[model samples]
Target: MLDIFLMGLLMAQYTYTGYDASAHVAEETKNASTAAPKGIVMSVVISIIGGWILLYSITAAIQDGSEAGLTTLNATATGLPPAQVFLDALNNPTMAKFLLFIVCGAQFFCGMASVTANSRMSYAFSRDDAIPGSKHWKKVNPRTGTPTNSIWLCIVLSSILTVPALFNETAYLAVTSVAVIGLYIAYVAPVLLRRLKGDKFKPGPWHLGRWSAVIGWIAVVWVIFICILFVLPPTLPITISTFNYSPIAVLAVLVLSIVLWYARGKKHFMQHLDKEQLATDEKKLLDEIDD
Candidate 1:
């Protein structure tokens, strides 16, 4: 029961993911310091309200309280529980298909936003020479001011990552767990750093003021808790087929990152840009804008 509760909590967190896209696009936003934080907050707030309503609607639509209804939902012809609920509730195949179509459209937009955020992140890292082949990835399209190379890199890498799911269903779960765990870790790192820094940590325009420490600690702790839960097997008496591989995936990434950092990145990667270089880049961007 506890494991089921934890899994539900983890799924809720996954639904709340991707709000950080606001922060990733800050460089292109107006009054970014204020706007970006507000965007992130509002996005989460809206998602929470909207997601709750959607869930409530779905639950209310479950017309059957009998074991037969459960069996039908579980063995849905479309292989989707939600679609079965819609079909059973409405008794209309066309309506269920329409609802599923709407869901697919929403998922497409969500994926697009993720891709955009990932590409921007890669571009920023490449600009700092933090990644291999930085020279190629850091290039921006002159006409669109977009990171075409980084965008393509993100697309290709994401496509390759999904290939494992084609062969094994368990691999799909592991991939999702790894992705969520990785995202939450990235989200909480700065908050944890800020808490550790205490008085030395500079507060940004969107800071929580007197409540910053409390909220930051809560965020960090929650992330750590979920990360642990994510690596645990979802089912008991787990066999090879049901094993959770998120820990293995995460460890492999950590090892690879450490090796790369020690071998090359530590020497070449600039953690912070020089003030003169920043100014030069700003001026160059202004010149390009003017032209």
Candidate 2:
């Protein structure tokens, strides 16, 4: 039982890693073209290995639990054969601290992966003149073939917000949960717009069509459910009191994301001015300033 819970926790962590690899390499590939093929293969390999690792860990945990003469699992591990085992190690201060570091580490990497992926998306969107800061983010470093500045910009911002994790376990989980939801919400746009709306926006040259929509909607719902569950006070509490204000934090993050989307993106929509118009606008601005 302990093993099963441990395994689940470990797998949750492995989930966060592979995505970042693809993002960090975004610029190196033939004008932003290479990561998809490499990313797909990379994901496949890691996912298969990651799954096997979790399976092995759970099997070992079961063996350990049986040796301890535990007919059933303890209260704290995650996967059951033990219903909810998030805190089996809490009784042991050292183990609790270790697990805290592990959870924080995995979630941190997961968030980092998100930062990578998002910067690529933001950079790509900007390249199309569809988002703010498009020119700078999409600019490749002359030598590295990386969106160097954008990568650092995102990493820095993500790290700062991640600071909240130092406060309490609940805060850590809540904010990450919110970030997770934001990821899927951004994904849903391409899905729902194509599938439900049929807005004549065909898939891009390198696009996933009908199937993507199905997967996207399913994933969105799945993630939403998990995000909600994550913030909910655990049905079983490991400590003296359950946590609070998790949903509130989630709301704040959501609001911030929305504000950012509009503050940065609103002007770009349907407002693509040709070079001449832009030059004229710039000249006018300069004249007004001089006046």
Candidate 3:
């Protein structure tokens, strides 16, 4: 039973890793890939330390000679559901409060870090006019030299997300997992686009050169694999609605909208795709600012 639960936890961690990698890249770190890499490394280090500490504490507790072997659940004593075992703490009030405070601090810090990345992604998508509500999401306040509209949009979206979670925790995880798959698929696009380079493949500072073709092909396949893994049903037997596929469904709608934007209606929507020049200009402006 422990082995099975642990396996599920590891798989869930993979989905979480998938979700975080995007923010680590083009969004949060901007041009500083190394910073994102370092942040990820540090996060892993801290998490492992925390896990080790928890393991040692549990080991000590088990040795204390409790009938259930110091198991927080104490299945025999509590007679409550296994889930509530962890909540049944043995700590003193003062120490328990301190632990709660530390937990809150960690969560708040995570929120701050996540928001920084989310806002940047919103800005980037808006700048390219790809988001549905581009004007607000991509908007930049000249006075502040920042994307104020983008920041507000993020707040609205985050608030909206909390509504669903009020109903169920599994709902939230399933939904978020699905959304992440679509984002991953979008991320793989540029990597695969370099295959023929056709005519408009402008080489950026991060060029992979002769290996660029191979990289794109490899990345596209990897993305597909990740998407499949993420979209799988949470239960042993895979079924369509059993787990979250929201991201793929969302991406499907976006793709349809994009098609109409280009061919059927909303011609202005296609303009964003024609803005390779924006990336070029943005890069130049950044170089000048650095100079």
Q: What RMSD, rounded to one decimal, does every model reach? A: 4.1, 10.1, 6.5
Provide the TM-score for each candidate, comma-separated. Answer: 0.91, 0.57, 0.59
lDDT of 1 at 88: 83
Candidate 3 error regions (>4 Å): 1-90, 142-144, 187-223, 236-266, 269-291
Residue 276: error of model 1 in Å? 6.0
**lDDT score of model 1?**
0.89
Q: After superposition, how far is residue 38 of candidate 2 from its true place, in Å?
A: 7.5
- Model 1: colliding residue pairs: none
Candidate 2: misplaced stretches above 4 Å? 1-27, 31-38, 41-45, 58-63, 66-115, 122-140, 143-145, 198-201, 204-217, 235-241, 244-246, 261-264, 268-291
Worst 10 residues of 3 by lDDT: 78-87
Candidate 1, poorest ten consecutive residues by summed lDDT: 282-291
Q: Taking the tens digit of each residue's C-alpha lDDT, what string does model 1 give over 1-291?
A: 577778888678889899999989999999777788899989999999999999899988898857897777888778789988888888988988999999999999999999999999999999999999999999999999999999999999999999999899899988889899999989998888878887875555665688878888899888999999999998979999999999999999999999999998998897567889889987775554444
lDDT of 2 by residue, 189-220 (tens): 55566667665643433445456767767856
Candidate 3 clash figure, as a count? 2
Clashes per candidate (backbone, < 3 Å): 0, 5, 2
- Distance (Å) between predicted and true CA of 57, model 1? 0.8
TM-score of 3: 0.59
Total clashing pairs in model 1: 0
Report lDDT (CA) for all predictions.
Answer: 0.89, 0.59, 0.59
Q: List the residue pairs that clash in candidate 3.
A: 178-247, 179-247
